[model samples]
Target chain A: MNIKVLFFGILEEIASTHEIIFSDIHDIKALEKILNNQFPDLTRYKYLISVNHEIVKNNALLKDKDEIALLPPFAGG
Target chain B: MNSKFLVSGAIQLEIVTKSIASHSNKLNIGAHSVFLGQVRNDVINRKKVRAIDYSCYQEMADKQFQKIKDMIFNKYNDLTCMHIKHSVGQVKAGEISLFVFVSSGHRIQAFKACEETVNLIKDEVPIWGKELFDDNTYNWKENK
Candidate 1:
C-alpha cells in the first residue's frame, strides 16, 4: 500500500515539500507515526488529518494509493 | 470555476456587482447582509505585512462549503440566497480577501445568517493563510 501524504501551512514549510509518498501504511495512526519520525518539527503544532478528502479520526483505515492530507488549524474568514 | 465559493487571486468588485445583478429578478428577497474581510497591514516586530498567500485543501473545502450551505439553509427559514468568495494565492494588504453575502425576506434573518455563515466558515473550512511580510519573510496566520 502506498499513501500520498500532503503537507499544508506551517507543516509544508517544515517538511519542505507539498506532498510525499510512503510505500507501506496500514492505517492513519501508522502514517502519523512515520510522518512524525520523518518531520519531527511537525510534532510541535496541532493538526488535522484528511483521508481521501474527508477529515478522519485516529482509527480511520487506509487504502492503497490513498491521498492523505495533514492540515494545520484553519484561518479562513 | 464550477464551485460557488471562489479561490482566486483577489475577489473583484465586478464579481460582487454581477452577483447582485443576478439576484435582481428574485423579488422575494428583501434584505441582504454582506461581510467583506480585508487583509490588514499589521506591523509585527517592525515587519509590516505586505500581503497574504492563501491555500486550502480544495476538494474538502468545496465539500465543506456545500455542507455549510445546506446547514445554513435548513437553519434559516427565510434565507433566499447566499454567496461566498475567498481569495487564494497572493492578495495585497487592504484588498478584499473574503466576501460573504446572505439574503432573506427580513433584515434580521439576513444579518443573523450572514454572521453565522462567516463564523462557521472561519471555524470549519480547511483554508490557511500565510502572511508575507515586507522584509521578504513570512509566517502562517493562526485563527484567533
Candidate 2:
C-alpha cells in the first residue's frame, strides 16, 4: 500500500517535504523503522505520528488514502 | 454551524471571513474573542530574534487544527463561530504569526474558547519555526 508521509522541523531539513511511496509495510511501526534507517537524525528528536489527522500509536494500521504526518514537538507560543 | 476555518503554509495573514456582513449580524453572537500571536525579537540567552522561518508538516498541522475545532465545538455550548490562521515561511518580529477568533453568545465562553484553542495549537500543532538571530545565525526550536 502507498501512504503519504510528512516531515517537519529538523526532520524536514533532513527529509524534503513530500510523500514517499512504500510498497510493502505491515504497519506504521515498519514504516518508522524504514524511515529511521534512512534518516537516523530523526530518531534523536521527539516526534508524533498522525494517521489521517488522528494521533496514533506506532502499531496503527494504515489505509490507502490515509495521510500520515510526522510532527516534531512544537516550541511556539 | 457557520464558521470560517483555514489551514495553510503561506506567509500572508488576512482577516478570514466567509461573508463580511456576517459580523454585523448580532442575532446569534453576543461576544467575540480575538487572539493574535506576534513574533518576538528575543529568545533564551539574550539572543535577539531577527526573523522566524516557519514550516510545518502541512498534512498533520491541518489535521491537528481540525481536531482542535472539533474538540471546541463538542465542548462549548454557545459558540457560534471559530477561525484559526498560521503563518509559514519567514515572519519578522512584531508581525502576527497566528490568529484565533471565536464568537459565542457570551463573553466568557468566547474568551475561554479562544484561549484554549491558541494553547492547543501551540502545544499540539506540528508546525515548526526557526529563529534567526541578528548575527546571521539560526536555531531551530525543539518541539516540546
Candidate 3:
C-alpha cells in the first residue's frame, strides 16, 4: 500500500516537501514513526492527521493511495 | 456552493455590499449577522506584523467548509443563508482576511448561528497563517 501524505503550514517547512509517499505502510502509527524519524524537527509542533479530508484520532489503517494530510493548528477566522 | 466558500485574495468591499443587496428579495430573512477578520499590525516579541500569508489543503478545506455549512443550517432551521470567504496568499495588515455572513428569520438565531459558525471555522479548518513581521522575522499563527 502506498500512502500519499501532505504537509501543511509549518509542517511543510519542516518536512521540506509538500507531499511524500510512503510505501507499504501498515497503519497511521507506523507512518508517524517514519515521519518523526525522517523529519525530527516536526516533532516539536502539534498537528493532526486527516485521512481523506476527515480528522482521525485513532490508529486508522492506511490503504493504497490514501490521501493523508498533516495539518497544524488552524488559524482561520 | 463553491461560490460561497472562497479562498482568494483579500475580499472586496463591493462583494460584501453586493451580497447584502442580493438578499433583498428574501423577505423571510429578518436579520443578518456578519463577522469580519482583519489582519492586525501587532508587535510580537518586538516585531511588528506586516502581513499574513495564508495557505491550506484546498481539497480538504472545501469539504470541511461544506460540512460546516450543512451542520449550521441543520442546527438552525430558521437560518436562511450562510456565506464564508477566507483569504489566500499575502494579506496586508488592516486587510480583510475572513468574512462570515449568516441570515435568519430572527435575530437570535442569526447571531447564534454566526457565532458558532465562526468558532467552528477557526477550530476545524485546515487553513494556516504565516505572520510576517516588519523586521523580516516570521511566525506561524496558532488558533487560541
Candidate 4:
C-alpha cells in the first residue's frame, strides 16, 4: 500500500511540502524507521503522526489514498 | 442568542459587527474587552524576528475554537458577544496575529471572557507559526 507523508516546521525545510509514496509498509513503526533512515535529520524534530485526521498508535491498517499528516507542536495564539 | 463566527486562513480579521452591535444593544452592554496579539520582533537569545509563517490543522483548529467559544458562553453570565480572528501564512513584525473582542453587561465578565478565550486558543488550538529572524534562522515555538 502506498502512504502519503506530510511535513511541517523545520521538517519542511529538510523535506519539501509534498507527499511521497512509500510502497508496502507493514505498520506505522516500520514506516517511521523507513522515514528516519531516508531523512536522518528528522530524528531530531518532535512530531506527531495522524492517520486520516485521527491520531493513531501502533500498526494501524493503512489504505491507499489515505491522508496522513505529520504535525510539529503548534506555536500560535 | 446568536453567535456569528468565522474560521479561515486569510489574513483579514474576522468581524461580527452587526451581531455584536445588535446583541450589545439588546443587552445594554456597557463594556467591551478587546485583546489584540501582534507579531513581535524579539525572540529568544536576542534573535530579531522578521516575520512569522502561520499554519494550522484547519479542521481541528476550527472545531477547537468553536468549542472554546461555547465553553466561555456557558461559564460567563453577562457576555453579549465575542469574536476571534487569527492570521495564517506570513505575517510581518507589528502585524496583528490575533484579535479577541468581548462585550458584556459589565466590565468584569467582558475581561474574564477575553482572557479565557485567548488562553484557550494558545493552549489548545493546533495552529503553528515559524519565526523567521534577521539572521535568516527560523525557530518553531514549542509548547512547554
C-alpha lDDT (0 to 100) for residue B64 of candidate 2: 75
Clashing pairs in 3: none
- TM-score winner among the candidates? 3
Query: Which of candidates 2 and 4 reaches a greater lDDT?
Result: 2
Error of 2 at B114 (Å): 1.1
TM-score of chain B of each: 0.95, 0.84, 0.95, 0.81
For lDDT, the strongest prediction is 3
lDDT of 1 by residue, B84-109 (tens): 89887899998999999898999999
Looking at model 1, the pairs that clash are none
**Higher-TM-score candidate among 1 and 4?**
1
Clashes of 4: 0
Tens digits of lDDT, candidate 2, B1-144:
122333333324446444224676757888888887888787856788877888765655677789999999889999988878787778888887788889889999998999999989989877788988988888886544
Give per-residue CA lDDT, model 2, range A11-60, as digits (tens): 77777655676666658988889999998887887888888777886588
Off by over 4 Å in 1: none
Off by over 4 Å in 4: A23-27, A56-64, B1-23, B28-31, B43-46, B74-80, B104-109, B135-137
Model with the higher DockQ, candidate 1 or 4: 1
What is each candidate's DockQ, to 2 decimals? 0.86, 0.57, 0.90, 0.51
State the lDDT of candidate 4 residue by residue for B1-144, as single tens digits. 021233343334334454455565464788888887888787678888888878777766677788889999999989877878787778888877788888888999998899989989887777788888888888886655
Tell me how far the alpha carbon of residue B63 in candidate 1 is from the true structure, in angstroms, after superposition: 1.0
RMSD values, in order shown: 1.4, 3.9, 1.5, 4.5
Q: Work out the TM-score per prediction.
A: 0.95, 0.80, 0.96, 0.74
lDDT by residue (tens digit), candidate 3, A1-77: 78899999999999899999889998899999999999999889999999999899999988988999999999986
In model 4, pairs of residues that clash are none
